[model samples]
Target: MKIFLTGLGFVGSKLVTHLIQSPENQLRVVSRSPSATLPAGVHFEQVDSLEKVINWPTLIGDSQVVIHTAARVHVMNDSCDDPLEEYRKVNVRGTLALAEAAAAVGVKRFVFVSSIKVNGEETFPETPYKADDVPAPRDPYGISKLEAEQALQALSSSSGMEVVIVRPVLVYGPRVRANFYNMMNWLFKGVPLPLGAINNKRSLVSIYNLVDFIGVCAKHPRAANQTFLISDGQDLSTTELLQKMGRALGVSVRLLPVPVSMLKLTASIVGKSGISQRLCGFLQVDIEKNRRLLDWVPVCSVEEGLARTAQDFLTGRRA
Candidate 1:
């Protein structure tokens, strides 16, 4: 089978690795630069602009599936004057362009990787998002992702191009970056962290498990026109998460019991209430629908996933 992937960021890269491991798949990647050190047996092209998309018509015309994992992730960089507009350009417009291109060429299926934030950043106590729940994005990134899902569904209706959307929460493991990186740095140093009093529950996904689920969706007949919220199916408090991470790093926690209210106040003054809230707040996803629909369960526990990540960190196997 021929599979085309757009985007080479963190998730995209991991997806490519998964595809390469599949013996029956021939993979092609499209990006702005074609100079990536991809695994053996993968093809590439450079897409300079939305108008300059390569012979995607011909490429996807013969492909079995197209997995769209490329996007401008949430950023605090200064280049974004209007974050909403910036998100729309790439996450929404670029996504539609790619989907339209695929549809034009008669691609069978298009799987979009979306964010859990499409439901909301923080999950309330009694109400977690179900597959049938309407999206309520609270940030530019989430809004763009939700908009893209809508566009793809419309395209699917008109062109008979099957669309499957997977919303994953806080994917972590090898080749992790940003927040996970900082978290690991602190854990590895055995420094005292101020997250002991954080009693909030959050859901996280292992990159391995996420990629595995995507592989199932790629060919599963039951996955057509479906949307899934994926995680390890384990909800954990922030303190429990930290403790597991510390254990994986072969270190004991030096947690300082600081009050959550004090942390919130400090974060607000510094304009980082969102990040602080994520570190010290409650956010969970209900994955029962995914389990029931696809009969899929995470193969690795959180502890096993964290151990792999810790090994990657110690052995320099990932960045």
Candidate 2:
């Protein structure tokens, strides 16, 4: 039951905390962040960088499953000279190298944490992105993830290494970074947010549930060579989402009911269109395949997930 895990970010760290609780699981984690804390008894290995090649064959030895969560994360309003090339270096090529070496060293399964953006960034109301929908990545980061999934599938076929791809939407939990964390801070500090009138629906997965699904995908025989779209199975509008966060944080929302069209216009003028799109976009995912094929259900409800995150934020348990 030896498992090799890469990336010690919010998602990977949570996965470790969950997996190490099982006595039957032997954990080996590899990451460039040597400063990351791990539970006692988990073996750790350091690597130089994701984009750089290492002796992965030696590093992944005797592990039955590998969960890869490392990559160059998506940057909003990217100013890079060549964002696609930069993302492909780490997300695509780096992943292929790791999977190839894992296969060489007899790793049985590779679980890839992908993004819902691979099915395009938006969906019409009541029409969620399906598990088998054609990939239509709108940005460089999404494109890179899609490419990595393709490469992994080919390697899985030729090398007999099982590959499971899980595409999750807007994962939220303790120690979340980037915009989600920023939104939480605003809610905590009682900032006047202009998202009250946004009528867009978004599907979100809790970190606890996502890690649980990853564990299931790692071991489930039916998960081999399949892609899963997962969420809390509850979709919420932007206004409702902020309201819930406000309640969780024990604060009243100073949410301004601004017009969505005006907000988008202002964002366009200021070159922050991405933020506006996220605030007023419709992105829902259908997790029917996750239930039908894997018989999996989310481990926690959204209310519980938000409550845990709120507790951590108030107490400074994780950052």
Candidate 3:
């Protein structure tokens, strides 16, 4: 497969690296600014516009597959006046523009990396989000991703391009940042945490597993025109996650059995209600379809993945 990879951020960069390692595959990365740390001997095109794909046909020349993973993801303190519009500009419009260009260039499969938030912010323990669930995006980012998914489906129908959408829950692995990274830091340092009582179930995929699934979708026959919700096939509660993380970090876990109601109340007062929800909410995915349709199971167990991430963090800390 002559694959054209986009984004080159967290997921994209890891996906591209994984795909290119196969001797049977040919991969070319497209980025607005090339990373100096990309694997040696990798071929990538540096351009001025990743969002618009300026001169797209020539830029994407002769590629048979495109794995698009770019987006304006969640921001901490966004300064934008209309966050939804900003998100749409990159996630919806830019994705469609690139998809059309890829179709025009005769690309056969376009795998899009979407988020679990498209289904909603929370799920009941009895009702894990499936790929076919009606989207209930609770935030601007989720809404934009849902819009982009819809647009891609419409484009695929009209242009005869095979579109595979993969919606992954919180992705964590070696070098993961943001909340997962902070979780590690807190656990490793034995920071006082009120998360012990949080019994909410959340699904997380290792970057290894996510990249593996993306590679499968890029070429699997049944994956064409299909959407998949993926995870490690294991769900963890906030308390369990912290405990496991402490073990991985070789630290004794210290947690306060703070009541959920008190946590939410305090967070709301401090304008961090969203943080409370994240720490004490339910979000899980049904990956039965991924297994039944594609015969895909996560390549790495959650324990192994967490161990690797913890190892990397420790190595970095020591260095």
Candidate 4:
């Protein structure tokens, strides 16, 4: 199989590594620069931007699958005047252009890596977001992704190209950045946090599991024209997660018993409401659809995944 992939960031780079392990598969990456640390045999194409019409027909020629992982990811303090329009330019318009080009070139499958935010920011305490749930994207990024999914589905119907959408919750692993990485750093340094009272349950995916599922979707017969919400299937509270991270780092977690209400109030006052919600909110996904339809299971347990992430952090390996 010939695979054309976009992006070389966290998930995409790992997926590229995994795909190249199979000698029968050939990999080509599209990026703005030719400086990616890809395997020797993998092909690389330099493209200015996904939003522009680049010779995609020739670029995607003979490719069986196009895995799209690039996007205008959500920005915490967006500087753009019209954030939604900015996101639409890349996430929606750019994605459709690539999909159309792939379809024109007879690509059989297009796997889109979407986010769980498409379902909503939060879930009910006991109820988890399902794959078929009505989309309620509250943020610009989520709305853009939802629109891209709709456009892709329509393109699939019209062009007879298989489209598979995989929505993954907070993916964490080696070389992770942003808030998760900061949390890991704080934990490693034995910084005391006041999240011991957060009792909300959240779902997260290990990069290993997400890449495995993407590979399955690339070739699985039942995965065609399907949407999947994937996770490790193990939900954890904030306190539990911190405890587990501490264990993985071989350190004793130092969490103060701060009241959840007080924490939220302080966060609101400090303009960190979003951070507070993520730390103390319920956001779990039901991944039964992927498990039942594709017979897919997470390759690593949560404990194992956490240990691996901590080890990578300690060793300074990108992994």
Give per-residue CA lDDT, model 3, range 1-319, as digits (tens).
8888887788988887798788788877877656658776667787666566667788678889999887888786678999999999889998988999999989999999998889998988767999998889988999999999999999999999999999999999888898888888888888999887987898989999999999999999999999999899999999999999889999999999999999999999999988888889888889999999999999999999999999999898899
TM-score of 4: 0.97
Better of 1 and 4 by TM-score: 4
Give residue 243's error in model 2 in angstroms: 0.5
Q: Can you give the lDDT of residue 231 in candidate 2?
A: 96
What stretches of model 2 exceed 4 Å from their correct place? 317-319
TM-score of each: 0.93, 0.96, 0.97, 0.97
Better of 1 and 3 by lDDT: 3
Top candidate by lDDT:
4
Ranking by lDDT: 4, 2, 3, 1
CA shift at 142, candidate 1, in angstroms? 0.9
What lDDT score goes with residue 276 in model 2? 82
The sequence of per-residue lDDT tens digits that candidate 1 reaches over residues 1-319 is: 7898887877788888888897999998877655469998888876775434656686565777999887878785436678988888888888898889888887899999999989987877656677678888888889989999999999999999999999999999977888887888888888898889888888899998898898888888899999999999888888898899889888888899899999899999999988788888777888887778888899889989999988888777333
Worst 10 residues of 3 by lDDT: 47-56
- Root-mean-square deviation of every model: 2.0, 1.6, 1.3, 1.6
lDDT of 1 at 25: 93
